[model samples]
Target: IQHALSGLGYAAVKGVRQGKFFVLNLDGWGREEAQKQLERISKEVLTNPVIEEYRFEIVD
Candidate 1:
């Protein structure tokens, strides 16, 4: 997951004791677009159905 995010230009500054954080600089893209892109990336790259599952929420 960390590797996938890093490849997409997000910096995984913290990933051990506190789970993970991918710091992304989405230049000027709107929140909705960014969220959609991240969702695709997570589904296609970050997750392996044989081993992992995830759920998320957007708080705004």
Candidate 2:
């Protein structure tokens, strides 16, 4: 993507990566529990740490 964009006059694009996004509605959970579950899910289920990275944000 970056290479193509740079060829197309986008000199400012240093790099480009594609990733997935998800929104999980945890019903009635507190911050601590949510954090724990999210961490476990991210490391164990959502991503392959060998090649992929993951991050999440919680919103009210």
Clashes of each: 0, 0
Which ten contiguous residues of candidate 1 have the minimum total lDDT?
13-22
Q: Of the candidates shown, which would achieve the greatest lDDT relative to the real structure?
A: 2
Off by over 4 Å in 1: 1-21, 55-60
Any idea what lDDT model 2 has? 0.89
Please identify model 2 stretches exceeding 4 Å from their true place.
none
TM-score for each model: 0.43, 0.85
- Roughly what TM-score does model 1 have, to 2 decimal places? 0.43
* lDDT score for residue 8 of model 1: 78
lDDT of 2 by residue, 1-60 (tens): 898999999999998989898789898789988988999998998889899989889787
lDDT of 1 by residue, 1-60 (tens): 666667778785445232443444566657798789878776787776576665545444
35: Cα error in model 1, Å: 0.9
Q: Candidate 2, after superposition: displacement of residue 13 in Å?
A: 1.4
lDDT for model 1, please: 0.63
